[model samples]
Target: MGKTPLHLAVTGPSSVVASWILEKDLGLIRIEDVLGRTPLHYCASAANFDLLLKQGASVNHVDKRGMAALHGVCYLGASDLVACLLKWKPRLDLRDKTYGTPLHCGVISGSIDVVMALVEKGAPLNAADANGNTAVHVAAKLGRHNILRLLIQQGADISLQNTNGRDPEAIALDAAGNVGILSILKHKRQDSPESQSILNIVDEDTKASSLDNQVTGNDSPDFLWDEDSMGAAEQNELMGLSQSANDDLYTYEEQQEYCSTTFPKPAPESQSNNGFGKAAFCLPR
Candidate 1:
């Protein structure tokens, strides 16, 4: 029994000696085996599409998965191989069983060349997959900001919502993509500068309140200073001074003695409970 041509091509090499064996000695290998690609599938998956194509591989051949060689190239976003496949004019609109066309695969890969090549080749841009996700949706979900921008420019619906009720901004935020998307959205709304100015005013008010609290030794509700912070040490010194300022705790007689010794005041005309005078004490004769 002759070995199948696919088996020979897969195991055989592109070397002159091996080619002679398959071509001259065997004569069993068919052109279809080389084009149908039992070998190209393995090569393309391994990113060896260049070698397979050089070894007389067909660009239009579909694997068992219903994916053409071009589809594989698009998945890898290999511009060179994609260009070669485009040159061959393979069926660009060919979709797999899941309605995943080459254009779908190209967008998922997020390569400009792959997408542009498919678009140029007349691949339908608005087609959605089983999940009703257009290429723009996929790009947004993956947080491919530039790719999303490109799709938008190409008439992709930025407002289109997926089945989960999420729009592009929500998806990008969920994915934590670059803050550039947030800035873009803010710019579109034209309210970013106003919001920023309001925030600055609030922040300045907070700072002013904090400074007043520091000068008055009053702890602001918002400014909780940790015991280990330098601010706490400074606060403790101020609190000590405040504690010394509480003169109401001293006795009235002790205060009068303190005042007399400290200030050498003149004797009062009479010691009495006069409402107009400071409390006085009679000294012992």
Candidate 2:
């Protein structure tokens, strides 16, 4: 025989060799045959963690990707294996050699269950990789609507922009073709009135700045608003719209009062000393 039935079991062949090994002898294979997989990887990939784990397989061993059994279980959507992995206290923050975390995998798979599992297990929903991409950005780019909702609900940074100067919403709107995803992205705003007020201010400034640039023959206005600023403004507007649409949205009570008051509020503390009508517009936050 070229290889023993137990060896075939390790190879993941469908030769019923695992059963033969179990029948041939108990504990016949040393723990080392469990290999980098710890049997959990094979079981998870095969959807049979229960039996494999019952036979004393480890749950935290890193595979070739530096992912533990829990990581594998996440992609497999193995609920039981996940529970078992949680019981074992597998490192929730375990990152692959490439710095990819379980949350990254969850977002890519579009599996909300895996997302919730990792989140409940203390996985950082806002954790960014070397590329500064959060789970929200991943979900949005992939158009994972439900996953995006779960992430936003958990307070993922809706405003965090990537190096490419695009926030989650911008990416989602560009890549997301699903109406459901767009609908979810439509509602992750943090401040409506404040954002709207800022945009109105920006628009007025833009027009004035345009005229100033034209008259002065200056190609660049004072701190000309770049694409990044425009995207930030747009993000703020979306957040504002989202908050206004949902009654359950939370806004600062002070801002609410100011927005509702008939009288014009005083200039921001930063602009109080400035000349009349010079309300700190264009000042960097």
Candidate 3:
């Protein structure tokens, strides 16, 4: 308990070292480093993560640093680790001492995959840290237009001022010359729950109508049967899919693509397509 054996083992070249320590004491999985990081906190490999979880590691355990293994995994930029942790259904919007949520911590790590994972999990896109830094603030400060765009499309509040009173647009505009990022951040609003509810209802209606079309095998004007539209029930099923155990954006993207008939499609391209290039992405925050 004097040191984080799991963290050591995970960072060490020998997986067997971790295996041996864990075998000696399964409780070691819960042991924290001086900084309060657990073995789960140090895991960079999915195999180690799976093994620890199977052995009773708690995904929600926070380290002395005020972050849980879930946030730590996101910070590690391991898509596999992020995928594995979300299946455990860790609490969303849980803040550290600094009030940083997993969404905040994840965005700092440069893993858009992890960011997408949190977004799909319905993590509050508008939630801010003690410093009033929303995920958008962090992304914009770092010039991560892709993450910024994703957060924006998912209804993140870009207009919210941080502790310094700068909105996301101001942060990005001052830090970089990317006017496109500014243009994207400038467009936002308070999404009404009524609209979301209407979306749900419309999805249900689409399903019913699509089912009729399916039975008739007749092309219906109500929806496109191709890459765009699906039955309402199936669409609803996809909307609730964030909690599913299956990993990655495949299901989320599939849902977005299939439900385009109801929700307008937002551009999902990375900044590279806009001439900014991935090479310019800010280093992990």
Candidate 4:
């Protein structure tokens, strides 16, 4: 019986529908369903919050769960959306009923990009929920190794204890299948963190060990060659006929661009400052 035209407008398959529906009654913009979710909530979850902000959608209204429309913005991993919502200056630190801040939502969404956005926007890194669990705690418990590392790098207070008196590292140890997370935590105690070596060739006797596992291991698929199809004198690297073996795998040099951070800096937000469901998206954008 409800969703009113305004609720549907919030869905915004196109801005035209929202604008046209609003022409009939501007009041629809503030309408809420039985769930207490407003058009702005849907707008934050779907359409451009910038477009909605300009359209006069209320950003403060929370649904039954006490989550502001800004919380829903985490559902979208797009940096553009992050930039738009940051402009609104919504309470970046607002908590949902569970006390989970926007950072927690982004972490739950498992979108590394989204997590970076919140961190850059000055969202609380150590804010705890009703359970005394912080985003770092959640990252470690969930085996989000990369996210956990970034949080710690940003000074998330790995020593912070939850209600149970367990720090993020302790939480990581308690959570099963978190060996990788545990290892990263352990490195923080060491004076020098050791990075895995890429590749290098020594003497001819040890040359075979330098190749990739695929090339040297027995599990590699059979490499077929039509010996008769080619002249015996021609180059036959696969056949191993050449006197000098050219190492194909490890001999190649890495060509990736050098960069300090992954996710591009979060828009115009300050350098110092800084999802929604089981997946990065809870509902269709």
Candidate 5:
């Protein structure tokens, strides 16, 4: 509630007014509201956010909740705002009071773009929150199949367990019986380099035996292939299986409905509250 004129101007609809306020008193950029959020923390508009950064706003400033501007932008799924913050090189792994990194916030916001940006900027994918749940665990528990797949592809540790001793796969199964999510998790584990190496060893052993059988003119076939082994075609099918299942599970409109119904966006008034918004801090702990 103690926001300065600069805070109001930056978050206001007009970027010109914000520029005017900055010109009048550049030090206002460093002023903190009652919640400890500087003007940068409330700059939802990418233009305004960039203006504050160029004007020397601190991207590292945290609100009372221990969330920096980067954390808030990531939670809002504002890729544009995120890009502005990234240029300033903020601490990507800065932990909020809830022990969540920006990667965790991005995952919960359901924006793959935000998640990818943070990942590309070197955010810790396997950073565990207070509950020992990584971004992978949160995505699984929330039935975010696409996000989970991205996390897996980005080298997130799927085997990490939470306080309840539940891994990502276990959490996925508990999330409304999300078999699609479970399948993706299992596929990731199976496709690991270690797993592939073991499988290759077994395949070579079997292939050698088949060659010996063929040389001895045994009744068995000249070549024996393990049905369990995945070929190029099988790999392609497996890759597409999740997408096909997702199509069957949720259409574009239905996905929008699901996200809205499950995680409604905060009201406009709430966006400028002491914290960024309820959604910004409502992440699973």
Candidate 6:
């Protein structure tokens, strides 16, 4: 890992020793390990992380995985560490290898506080990842009802679709079968000002067409929701859309396992500021 003494001292058992190492040589603050992780990148202790920052540690340095310290802390749901990083004004919307912003990581970690902090700080809410899935898509796909609600309240676009053309509503229904999430999205879309404006326009257009049809005595039949209305090919196409939505999602068990291994719960309060353990190296997937 090519960890220097400064890296070891900060992530080690003693914050006092880490401070001593920093005081001895400030240049160690900028040193990178074999993985290109600076001492700031490995400093899990909020106090130690702050100390390095005060000594001019670079917060924007990305490791081999194209992740900065903000990415790891957000994924770990470490609100304190996240707070420290935010004070430095690190790039709010920096994209990782997967093109996911820090807000996406916070949502994946299932930490409302982390998500709130990012949102309050003005992180881009609608930025999509490489797969065209925005924060809304991720929250819905993972069955995060509360997170989905928060994102919606903060003005995340619910109608945005992913690479497979499945929006959050379809993802909630087909991928997770989350009725609550679907209801929230549906209600937001219907009540949104944009949707209301579109509805009004559509209403006006319909009224004009109805008057024209009445004057011309047009007797063409309109499509209805009957068994004969949809052809075999259209039915097959609808079935394919549902199947594709399901195929694009991970199974519930798989999602749980991924969260467990990829974003370990924050360290206990007793160990919170001690050092980095499983929470330090959350690489982008």
Leading candidate by lDDT:
6
- Ranking of candidates on TM-score, top first: 5, 6, 4, 3, 2, 1
Better model by lDDT, 1 or 3? 3
TM-score of each: 0.47, 0.52, 0.60, 0.63, 0.65, 0.64
Candidate 3 C-alpha lDDT tens digits along 1-285: 334434544542234445645665677677775556666765656666777788898888876646676766665566787888888888877777542788876787778989999889889888877666788877876677788878877877776776555566555645544455655554443255434322232235554343233223333221121123456455323211123334223433443343345334324442223332221111111
lDDT tens per residue, model 5, 10-97: 5543466556557666888998866687878767577788788898888888877677878777776888888878988999878775
Tens-place lDDT per residue, model 6, 83-124, is 988988888777665437889889877899999999999999
Candidate rank order under lDDT: 6, 5, 3, 4, 2, 1
Model 1 RMSD, rounded to 1 decimal: 39.2
Clash-forming residue pairs, model 2: 189-239, 192-240
Count: clashes, candidate 6: 0
The positional error of residue 275 in candidate 5, measured at the CA in angstroms, is 27
RMSD of 6: 14.8
- How many pairs of residues collide in each model? 0, 2, 2, 5, 0, 0
* Model 2 segments more than 4 A misplaced: 1-36, 45-57, 97-99, 163-165, 176-183, 193-285
The whole-model lDDT of each prediction reads: 0.47, 0.50, 0.59, 0.56, 0.65, 0.65
Kindly report which residue stretches of model 4 are placed more than 4 angstroms away from their true locations once superposed: 44-48, 75-79, 190-285
Off by over 4 Å in 1: 1-37, 43-61, 97-99, 161-167, 181-285
5 or 6: which has the higher lDDT? 6
Tell me which residue pairs clash in candidate 4: 105-275, 106-275, 109-275, 119-274, 122-274
